[model samples]
Target: MPKITYTQPDGVQSVVDVNEGDSVMRGAVLNGVPGIVAQCGGGASCGTCHVYVDKDNTKPLPEMHPVEDELLHCTSSPRQDNSRLSCQLPVSAELDGLVVHVPETQI
Candidate 1:
């Protein structure tokens, strides 16, 4: 299983073990990470799962896809260079130590 840490704006952190092939968003949602509300499931149709990939592992993560780009623009929060839709990240051996930061809110 790949391990991921989701840190909220208030500094609350939730670390979850995710099965290979599962989206990081799904892992957050399933584990009850408060800052993530995956309203569009893993479709990338909504940006409720927006998060910032940790800079250390950001280069190792997959590049954003077109659909993810579109949805990322929907986030109510301002986007940053490292902004990403968690649904676009797949759980895998290469992402064993991925860290993501959940903004204060995503509506």
Candidate 2:
């Protein structure tokens, strides 16, 4: 399992131990974390699972595909340099201690 930290815009945090192959959205949704909406489940078709990867975290994430890039533009929150769809981020040993910030809104 990988321990991932999800931080809310209000500074609240939820630390969850996600199964190795599950997506970040899966971890948050299963644990009742308040910030991730995950409207499309893990399909990557919706931008509701938007999150900001911690700039200080050095772990490299997977390259974003064209679809995800396009969908990011549709997020209710402003897209950022570290913006990523939680559904696109899989859990792994290398991702332990990963911290992601939830934007103020997801629609």
Candidate 3:
């Protein structure tokens, strides 16, 4: 399991131990974390699971697919340099301490 930290816009944080190979959105949804909606059930079709990868994370994440890149433009919040769909980020040992900031809205 890898420990991932999800921070809400209000600065609240939820630390969860996600099973290896599970998507970040799945981990948050299962743990009742209040930020990620995952409206598309990790299908990469919706931007509700959007998050901002912490600038402090040093490990490299997987490359974003073309569909995810296109969908990011539709997020309710403004897209950022670190913007990513949580459903596209899988849990891994290398990303054990990964931290992501959840936006205020996920419509």
Candidate 4:
């Protein structure tokens, strides 16, 4: 399992153990982390699972896909250089301790 940390706008953090092949959004959703909406259930179309990959922790993540590239622009939060959709990020050993920041709103 990979351990990930999700930080909310208020600085609160939720650390979760994610199964190897599960999406990061699934971990947050299953653990009841408040900021990740995941409305489309990991579908790339929703953009509701938007998160900011901590700039210092992003290098180990896989490259962003083309669909994720497009949907990121649809998030309610202003997109930053590190913006990413949690649903598009898969858990892996290389990404252990990955930290993502949740936006204030997903809608």
Q: lDDT of each structure?
A: 0.85, 0.94, 0.94, 0.91
Q: Sort the candidates on lDDT, descending order.
A: 2, 3, 4, 1
Quote the positional error of residue 96 for candidate 4 in Å. Answer: 0.8
- What would the per-residue lDDT of candidate 3 be over residues 1-107, giving only the tens digit for each residue? 89999999999999999999998899999999997999889999989999999988897699999999999999999999999999999888998999999998999
Global Cα lDDT for candidate 2: 0.94
Q: Candidate 1, TM-score vs. the true structure?
A: 0.92
lDDT of 1 by residue, 23-100 (tens): 899999888888788887878888999999876764377877888887777788888888999888888888887889
TM-score of each: 0.92, 0.98, 0.98, 0.95
Give candidate 4 misplaced runs (Cα > 4 Å): none
| Per-residue error (Å), model 3, residue 17 | 0.2
lDDT of 4 by residue, 15-76 (tens): 99999899899999999999888888998999999999998874477789999999988889
Candidate 2: tens digits of C-alpha lDDT, residues 21-55: 99999999999999799998999998999999998
